[model samples]
Target: MSIYRTIGIIGAMAEELELLHRHAQMESETVKAGLVFYRGTLHGMNIIAVKSGVGKVNAAVCTQALIDLGAECILFTGVAGAVDSSLTIGDIVVSTACVQHDMDVTALGFAPGAIPYQEISVFPADEELRSLAVRASRDAVNGRVLEGVVLSGDQFIASRDKVQSLRDVFQGACAEMEGAAVAQVAHMNGIPYVVIRSMSDQADGSAHMNFAEFTVLAAGQSYAVIEGMVRSLQQA
Candidate 1:
């Protein structure tokens, strides 16, 4: 049996969380701290899922609520903009580390990505969970599955310049609004966490249009990978 009695899953968008909730067995909902939490079972595992609204603060609040609700581990799955030129829509990025691209303190001698009082700029994902996710992604999606850095910020990345700037600084595979914040909170709480993102658009001028067209499709791809990972953990 899995060691974790309760697993927490978070998504930035309603579409992503809603799909998972639909697949969950014996699901029930509760509202707390302006967020809705869904308690359920998937692949015979007890799970709590939440749609974290949009940004870092929302993600952090939802994560903490999940922890308070008895989650032992956390998993974040959502859609992202491709930061790398090689990544295409539907490609999955299982984050090895997450960094906030907007956290800048250069005037205070801290590096651009560094958080105040934190030694490392990047927060790492749980190794065991990441491995399971990578394996599951390979089986779930026909496109490439990569393990790399995911950069997060409050702004939606929709320009080539912004993408290039983030890549130059963090060397990230994907860019999103919530993953790094969730990672930071999990790290502080000493909880094992993992982030899975499916590319919904290239962070370019066309990003808005691309995301509008592919968000649902990308969310489905991410959900498939997460489902596979849950099954793997269940059998283990």
Candidate 2:
């Protein structure tokens, strides 16, 4: 059993942030990088949580700030558009790893998702954290839980063709706006990380409408899994 002294959580939207605020008993809050951070305890484990807006750059900045504030591990939670056809609204997709789907240097002979001068553009999550997350997901989500690659980019995906292309290139389970950025920052900083995303919509023509309707349900699933993960870590 192992527990990090302090864990940081980054949620992408109001729905996700609200669930976090309700779950953790924050004692004090501070503003850093134009983001408000709440410090408290979640199921007896120290927590610093924030809403990092909804982009790769924003996520990167907030992750570094959390690291500076003494977060031993970083967790990114939110809703995503499903890339895998099997996933439906309310299903959870815990990342085994994540990739920046928009990073392209194919002209320079680098892979579509690869970054120059880096060993790999696909950043892996901490194994133990992943295991805990998967277990917690199984318990917390009523819908199916899957562990697979999560693709992240700045654009909100709302096209079936785009989804098919991403799945073909990256083999991702889901696509979102922030997870891989957080993964990259956490990896570079030598901190353990995990990304737990709930599927709010299929990445199809009707994605926006579905997301609007189901984001709260998806966010709730994510919060439950994250809460379970924290409780299990505290017990461990």
Q: Tell me the whole-model lDDT of each prediction, alpha carbons only.
A: 0.89, 0.90
**Which regions in candidate 2 have their CA more than 4 angstroms from the true location?**
none
TM-scores, in order shown? 0.97, 0.97
The backbone clash count of each candidate, in order, is 0, 0
RMSD each, Å: 1.0, 1.0
Residues 69-188 of candidate 2 have per-residue lDDT tens digits of: 999998889999999989988888889999999998999999899999998689999999999999999999788999999999999999989999998898999999999999999999
Report the alpha-carbon TM-score of model 1 versus the true structure.
Answer: 0.97
lDDT of 1 by residue, 1-236 (tens): 99888889898888887678778885688899989888889999999888898999998898889888988999899999999888999999999999999999989998889988977769999999999999988998899999999999999988888888888888989999999889888988899999999999998899878787898898888788888888888887
What residue runs in model 1 are displaced by over 4 Å at the alpha carbon?
none
Cα displacement (Å) at residue 77, model 1: 0.5
